[model samples]
Target: MMFRQLFDHASCTYTYLIADPVINAAILVDPVLEQVDRDLKLLDELGLTLQFCLETHIHADHVTGTGKLRDIAGCLGIVPQGAQASCADRYIQDLELLELGKVIIQALATPGHTDNHMAYMVNGNLILTGDALLIRGCGRTDFQGGDAGTLYDTITQRLFTLPDTTLVYPGHDYRGFTASTIGEEKQWNLRIVGRDRDSFVQFMSHLDLPDPKKMMEAIPANEECGRVSVVV
Candidate 1:
């Protein structure tokens, strides 16, 4: 197993590459549009073939590189089954496993940040948590189709139930923190620390975060898999 973490400084997003070196099969999770070239270069240099592109959710801060990477690698673009991303080649449902060489990627429904949000588990050892659970905080439930109550359940019932040592790789991290264990998040994440659904909702509603600067542009582009105004 081989893993690489790529960070996008502008949006504080993280993209991950998990590969099975023995079979030369690989998958990219939550790849950033602006960083596709860098990612491709690295993949080329490593002599690995991209088998799939996995999206944790549709992002509002930055467009995803699913479509671009698909073109580059002729790989499948995987997104949540019910998600509305236009470029998704494969619609993933709960517990759906994608077999790639020696690695198995399983999708876990974890809606909170969005109704169709999902988390991917790799070989039951690592979880790629989209916006559902961050390092010290959880995703804000103030956006479209976002519900605090749902987020609460998703975290406690679904994610927290995983093993204590399960590695957690989140989609975005404004702070320098890169990764953490499920146990650490369960113990320290402020959003879910001893707070009930109503209280959590109330707290999140008042956070007063500035609207994502690229929301207007990024959402549309992401829906189409990072294509600009013109069709490729």
Candidate 2:
């Protein structure tokens, strides 16, 4: 198994490249439109074929590269079941496994940041926590059908129950931190460590966060698999 974490500085988004090197097959998770060339170039350099481009949810921060990559690389575009993206080639349901040779990626429904979000657990050792759980802080639950209570439940129950050594790779991080362990987060994550469900809900309600700058453009575009304008 081969894994690489790529970053798009503009949106503070983390795009993951996970591959089964024995078969030279790869999957790109949460790709950004502006960084397609970079991702493709790396794939080329690594001697790998892009098999799938997967999205955790419809993002509000930056446009996705799935549409373009599908057009260029001819890879399948996969999204969580019930997501609004009609352009996806496949819809992955909770607990469904996508296997690449010996490596396995399992989708877990963890919808709070967005109503259709999923967190992927790779080979049962690491999890790609897309917008549902960040390093020290979690995603904001103010829009796009977000529910703070659900988020709290997701973090404390679904995620925290994983092995203490499981690695956490978040979708985005404003701070310089890269990754954390489940045990570390449970002990130190300021957002969830000490707060109960009600306190967490009340606190998230008062964050007063401004909308992502690209929300208007990104949401509609993402629903169409990141096409700036739909053909129909």
lDDT for model 2: 0.94
Whole-model alpha-carbon lDDT for candidate 1: 0.88
Report, for every candidate in turn, its global Cα lDDT versus the true structure: 0.88, 0.94
lDDT of 1 at 34: 83
The 10-residue segment of model 2 with minimum total lDDT is 223-232
Candidate 1 per-residue C-alpha lDDT over 111-169 given as tens digits, one digit per residue, 9 for 90 to 100: 98999999999989999999999999888878858888899999999999999999999
RMSD of each: 1.7, 2.0
| Candidate 2 lDDT by residue in tens digits, 1-232 | 9999999998999999999999999999999999999999999999999999999999999999999999999999999999988889999999999999988999999988888899999999999999999999899989999999999999999999999999999999998999999999999999998899999999999999999988998999999998886332
Flag clash pairs in model 2. none
- For this target, which candidate reaches the highest lDDT against the unseen true structure? 2
Candidate 1 C-alpha error for residue 181, in Å: 0.8
TM-score for all predictions?
0.96, 0.98
User: Could you tell me how far off, in angstroms, the CA of residue 153 lies in candidate 2 after the best superposition?
Assistant: 0.6
